[model samples]
Every structure is written in C-alpha cells, then in structure tokens.
Target: MKPQLLPRKSPRQARSKALVTAILDATAQVLVERGYAGSSTNLIASRAGVSIGSVYQYFPNKDSLIAALRERHATDLYDTLDAVLTRRNPQSLEEKLSAIVHGWMLAHQLEPDLHRVVEQEFPFFERAHQDQIPIYRTIVERVRQLLEEHREQLLPDNLDLATWMVLQTIESLIHAATTTTPLPVHQPAAIEQQIVEMLTRYLQVVNPR
Candidate 1:
C-alpha cells in the first residue's frame, strides 16, 4: 500500500493561526478585566503587543475577535470532552453518564473565564449553525448510541427522546452550577450529587413502586 499522506498546513495558514491565537489570548484577558464593552481593538492589540494594523489584518472588527474566541473556547471544550469520552470503558450506563458529567465539571472549573466570556459575550455569528449544531448533534448521537447498547434495559420507543432529554438536563445543570454567582461553599460536591441524582432518576428502569 502507498504511504498514507497527511495534508500539510501551508506556512501562511500556520502564521494566520498563530496570529489568531495571540489575538484570542489578548481578548480573553481583556474580557476578564474590562467586560465585553471595554474590549476594544486597540486594547487587544496593545495586550497582544501586536500593531493595531496587524490585529485588523486578521480580525476585521471586535465582533470578529469575539466570534473567533468563542469558537476556540468551544473547540477546546470539545477536544477535552473527546479525550474523556474516548478513555471511558464500556460499562454501566450510569457509570458512563457520571464519567461524562465529572469530566465536564472539571473542564468548567478549569476554564471558567473562557466559559463566562463565551456564554455572556459571544454573538451568534453567521457560521454558528455550521459550528454549533454539529457539536450538539454529536452529543445527542452519543447518548443515543449508548442507549442502543443497553436497549433491553431502557424503554425502547423513547430512546431518542430520552437521549435529548438527558443531554439537555445535564447541560443546563452544568451551566447553572458553573455560572451561578455568590459562589456556594459546597458547590463542587453539590453539583456532582445533583448530576448523579438527576441522571439516575431519569435513566433507571425500576418499575413504579
């Protein structure tokens, strides 16, 4: 067999990626300190130590910067999630759900700033459908696959509905737990327990008592 060839990134593409990364790093720092309204191109340029002209060379406006940053934030989360999901062993459905939830919580705790900026500041760009829909759809599909694997245990007809319901519930709970303020003293344990309880109640097949 001929050697499989990996497509190589052009030098221009590589440089563009570097510039975009620098701009995004600068934007995140500014957003943390100054809030969305104050994150101007000049400030981002100054923080990145790049020329204002250079900043505009890649990102046409501040909105473009925010959009790129938001996409990067999502991409980072998805990448981390992919790693966790890959390592998970085939096991009880409850164990799988717990593993996924724990990984999500850990990721949120580690990158709360990026999470806040993405949640609060990023606008829905033209490419949002292209970018975001696939991520959600993939999550739904994974849940559906897991349910299929354990179909004998679950109500057969409601698999898709259950998958979507479980996904939405977990996502909403995580967002609330991570984003809520007046930070709770027992937040870490509280969130974990809440996730386990919610999922167990929804997924368990015990007949009504």
Candidate 2:
C-alpha cells in the first residue's frame, strides 16, 4: 500500500499557515543537515519548536513533510520561472534564455542545500504528487510557447522536442553548477552566459551574435 504522503489538513488561517510554514522550514533544514534517513517527525518538531502532536496534526509522518517541502519548492521555482517567461517585455530568444537560466539559478541559490536534497529524492516526491500537474511539464509548456513565438528564427522543426532538449540542457547544467562543487563554470554570470550562448547556437539562431 502506498504511504499517506500528504498533509492531514490544509492550514487556512494566517496562524495555521505560519505554523505549517515553520514546520516545512524545519523539515528542509533537517533534510539538508541530516538527509532523509536521519530525519524524523520528532527531530522536525523539535527543530520547528512545536509539539509532536502539533506536527502530526498537519503531517501524518516525516515523509509527508518532506513531500510538502518538495511540493512547495517546486511551486516556488515554477512561479519564479513562469513570471520571467510570461513577462510582456520584448526580448530576443537569447535574452529570454539568459533571463530564464539566471532565474532558475537564483531560485536554487536561495536554498541550495534543500534543493539538492529534494531533487535527489525527487522520485519519492514525484510519486506523492502524481495526481497533480507536474511542475516541470508546466515550465516546459511555457518555454515551448516561447519557442513557438519565434519559430521562424529557430532551427528545430519540432518545437516540442526542441523545447525539451533546451530546457533539460539548461536545467542539467545549472543544477550541476549549483549543487556540485569545483565545476568548470563556477561563477553564476559565467554559467549563465555559457548556457545562453550554447542554447542559442544549438537552436541555430538565424543571426548569430
């Protein structure tokens, strides 16, 4: 049987929301410091400064909290990228690529440790959120739409496949640069420039800059 990997209830009131946020924040810290094996509701509750009962009041167990944490992290990232991608300001494809790569890196930079842990355990969290729209799909669809806007300038005939390749390439490079140390491109500015240039070339931008 599948474990109950969801909150027992949603926190609606401001106070309840704050309490839940505290719990998830503690969960992230604990997961970062101790990893999934070492984490537990007891440790999370203590870290959150809440009673175990209070923890159980919302989350059924530690896994549920981790799931919630991952969900929140994914939502926050999607929102950040969505805002950047959906903005009305006109931009060349290269400019859009730069903004998106930087935005993704910036979001991960804010919580690098937690991002690493949650992403490593994504399969588990992925299962927990199976009923909902995947965040990655939403971001990809948005980027694909951006590509559709400039199809004439792009080389790939299939924008859908091209979008996937582009996003996966950007995500893999940025994820490695942020989560792993001693990368070839260690600085954020350098990484962003390299990625934008790389994707622009791969997409065969009509007029190379």
- TM-score of model 1 vs. true structure: 0.76
Model 2, 50-147: lDDT tens digits are: 99999999999877887787678667878777676667354888888877887787777778788788777634665335336377567777789889
| Cα distance off (Å), candidate 2, residue 118 | 2.5
| Whole-model lDDT values for every prediction | 0.68, 0.80
Model 1 per-residue lDDT tens digits across residues 125-168: 43334325455456557778877877676654688788777776
For each candidate, what TM-score against the reference? 0.76, 0.84
Instruction: Please list the residue runs of candidate 1 whose C-alpha ends up more than 4 Å from where it truly belongs after superposition.
Output: 1-12, 88-90, 121-136, 182-186, 206-209
Q: Provide the clashing-pair count of each candidate structure.
A: 0, 0
Evaluated against the true structure, the overall lDDT of model 1 is: 0.68
- Tally clashes: model 1: 0
